[model samples]
Target: MTGLLPDNDLLVQFSQLFQQRTSLSNMQAHWQQYHWKETIKLGFSNHKHEDWKYTSLDRLLQYRFNYAQKLKISKQQCDCLALPLDSHRLVFLNGRFIASLSDNIYESYQVSSLVEQKNIPVAVHAEVFLHLTESLAQESLLIRLAAGKKSNKPLYLLHISSGQTDNQNKNIINSSYYRHHLLIEENAKIQVIEHFVSLNNQSHFTCARLTISLGDNAQLTHYKLAFENQHSYHFSHNDLILGNHAYAHSDSFLLGANLTRHHTSAQLNGKGSYISINSLLLPFREEICDSRTYLEHNKGHCHSQQLHKTIVYNNGKAVFDGILKVAPHAVRTDGKITNNNLLLSKQAEVNTKPRLEIYTDDVKCSHGATVGYIDIEQVSYLRSRGISKTKAKQMIIFAFAAELTESLKNKIIHQQVVTRITKRLKRIDI
Candidate 1:
């Protein structure tokens, strides 16, 4: 109540509630203490801060939301949120893991529920809201892959949020605050796909954080898919750390939520490590979405690349901020960052910035951003090819996104992403 978002009485109240619940939650004692202190120190985000200037969480503070203590739904409802058949899956409802609805694996991997464990791994966190998320989450999802092995099948995680299913808790609005931790041993390779969805039209808020650690010579592929309802709010953060010779690739598709914000931070901790961050953000109607990323070259021979593309239609808005930093000792580093935007309506708006901070003169870094309308010549060419004007425009926009999608290594997931994106484009009337 004494910090940034104190002006909103609802958020202030929720902060107090979360503070009081920390003692009752199952999180480890040491982490609880750390989170409590941090939450008290870093209260809420405001529009005045440069990092939060383009987005506002003030209006969302107008509504009150509660934590999910008990579930009141059937198995069939949970099944609606799973992935394709026979896939390794984990499901969470309102931030609590559901084992019965999950697939018990027999692979050379380990899956442990943090709520039932005694120790939690170190997290990759940089923002203030992260403290609040840790203070409220009852338990986290922990996944570990064995060393020197390649996963035969990709893993899927489904997070379902339905506001207050039981009538007895009708006055308590439902919200989820969860964290996920992933660890890959040396010479291991894994792929993870995460889906966030809302089961009902009720207004809910989902705040989550993920931390990934890759050992030497490890590789990881991560995909984030957001398809929440317009009545819901979504906030997420992913922190990745790679060791020597490790590789990481992250893909994000932001297509829903009334108000959404995503933060991705990757740290190249050892020499010869690399990472690539790619995202496609499409917002229609009155939705507002923000994507922020930071890549740190901590050691020599490290590389980072970012490609962020967004399409804003109707009165919707999008924001992108990308930063690349090279340490003094991180010589021979290579980095490139670019942000491209397509605006369909005069009412649509975008704010994009690509920043580079280098402490070493032996690094190569470049950054740029572009915002433009659909190319008329390209549209004309498509139209001449027997395509309608609207269809041609849609095709151009889709092609822009395909640059990122076509690079996906998983053929099934690539097709699914394309299909879902096409459906959303059609709903916007091309």
Candidate 2:
């Protein structure tokens, strides 16, 4: 196996497995014949590849990986993953949906085992989506929302994996990877919350694929939070497509795991579409957090804004790379993006990049990034008020993360995020 390209063995095995399972034989053959060899032929990692420079997947490959085996989840366990909202909840254990643990809803929405579906919407049937799909293990656990319907309550999707239950935990690194697909139709107002949790302190890998389509006047909000154990690794890919007059907002909170990488790519194809993205990432002591986003305006009169904040404590490290692209025909498009970091200790590290690529002269776009320490004035003021130095520092750190937490829109979720942040702060040494 080449040292440059990570996961060479898995890549080869997945290609063979994908070709045998997929009905799209032509595409599968194309990947197996060309893409597979090209990817694995590389002896060393193209670390300089701008997109991969920040988060080093190759370095992760050097360690042993424990591939989690598929497991069955009982109906009782599915109930625990149900959301507070009027959502259709489904549980996937070890990457396979458990029918016994799911509700059968065929009229309003199609809720069942994801393995039942053989095809996805055109919005998600793209080149990049296909490549990742082929490499990921297990058929995706799917969720399809009907058109023109508004969900009374938000949707909650819990991808729960108990390594002990799978018995594959004894593998070298014990990494588990998951692949799933979701689709939302037109005129639907849906809020989706995804939670990643583990029961043991084993090294794991989780990879998820999400495809969301917003029809005319549709509204959607997606919130993804990661709370994995110390030795786990997570890689997630999300794709969103928006129609005319549609709106979508994304909120993410990454607080756990030794290494976590989240990638989001959105394309605005319709006029009058709008999107806002907000994320809060806090990494502490040996934790590595890497996030990347790509937003494209393919048509005119589209707008997007992104704000990401990172707080690093102890020897933690973080990376943020954001790109906003406006196509040549996308006149009157507007976009603004910012990535900022608050470093709590000298040992903390941060890397931020906000990039803009515009091909249309009629568009307005801006991008920037900032990295710095806590505000001395705020700390000093709290210290003068009889608070201890350590306590004062904690207060300031929480305040910095408040901006991201307050954007949750849901009061309950906002409060939960705050509570989780506070808990992490308490666990760390000031």
Candidate 3:
């Protein structure tokens, strides 16, 4: 195929699947068709693209992944992967929602599987994967919190990917697509956690999209946990919009997948809005992790803060690209971004870029990045205190990551995050 359209095996497979699926509204079908054609015209990005300079899709595009078939999984299987928190759970297996496995919500909240709700705008992006998701997604979810109400418990959305087993007892490579939307009305508050995991060590591909809208004075706390297998590939996009005096806090933990990319964009469209985003990435062995964030200050008296940390080991690589832009009318805008990376091996690599674009002279903005190895001085000090070299190194690594984990206000979630980080850090050599 000359582009991503003519004879691409992945597109061909998804086209067939799309034709066989039913229950799509006329408007939805038209929307999908439009995006599919746009995807073919735009094609995929390469290293030459400014936004994709550090991450390449060559490895991910080489595989011919079939659509993931529905599989039967017990609640026990999901429990093993879930965090110990009291929350209402919504489960999805292989991109299809399982109503039997989900918990019922109260009357104060509105939840449904349909995507044809009014006032929900479709995603428009130049990226190929996003367009593909818009074209091929077979499952969708919409959650709305009523005005002046707050959720008593958090909402947990768990997405699990599992491949089919062949006659030779090997797993088949497959793909799944999903889309989710969350809406918080004025004076409402809610907390949400989106967890991604795998049932087995199967090679698969997952593409997901999430769009969040906060009305005036709304509050939201969001968390995303990605713990897929090392043989899988994952791509996700998040778009957030904040209204007047709205507040939003988002935390992302990336610790798995052979190749992964997360793109997030936040817009402060109303005055006095605030947003804070934090991310932790651990790429070990030959894995690659890429994260990108774009913040737009469209109104005055808005503020934003971002902190990103990455730890690389062996021959792994990590990338971070962040940009904050203030419009001409957005006076009194405050924005700050910091990125720190730790290299555990000489072969490990990190690529970081934090930029600011300001059109208003009254705004305050700063950006910085740092990349270095563990301090030998701290290790020596720990050794003199009768700690073993391996233990000392582990302690330092934990402390480096604790900055983000300790920020979690929920005790159960804080402990769970710390435990996962400790378990992953055990693989590093002293």
* Predictions in order: lDDT: 0.81, 0.71, 0.84
lDDT of 3: 0.84
* Candidate 1 local lDDT, 285-391, one digit each (tens): 88898999988899999888899999999988899998898889999999999999999888899999899989998888999999999899998999999999988
Per-residue lDDT of candidate 2, residues 1-430 (tens digit): 3234544545554454444443224443443344334433432344565555756665455454444566665565555544444555655665556556655553355554344333543433223323444344445555667778877766666776554434453444543445555566777777888877774565666666676767878898889878777677777767788889899999888888788878788889899999998788988998889888888898899999999999998989899988898989999998999998999889999988889999979888999888999888988899899999888998888778777776677876777678778888887887
Best by TM-score: 3
TM-score against truth, every candidate: 0.92, 0.85, 0.94
Task: In model 2, state the lDDT of residue 25.
Answer: 45
- For candidate 2, the clash count comes to 7
| Model 1 ranges with Cα > 4 A deviation | 1-3, 6-11, 19-27, 72-75, 115-125, 165-172
lDDT of 3 by residue, 161-209 (tens): 8754663534346788878888899999999898998888878889988
Better of 1 and 3 by TM-score: 3
**Ranking of all candidate structures by their lDDT, best first:** 3, 1, 2
Which 10-residue span in candidate 1 carries the lowest summed lDDT? 116-125
- Regions of candidate 2 where Cα sits further than 4 Å from its true position: 1-48, 72-86, 104-107, 112-133, 164-171
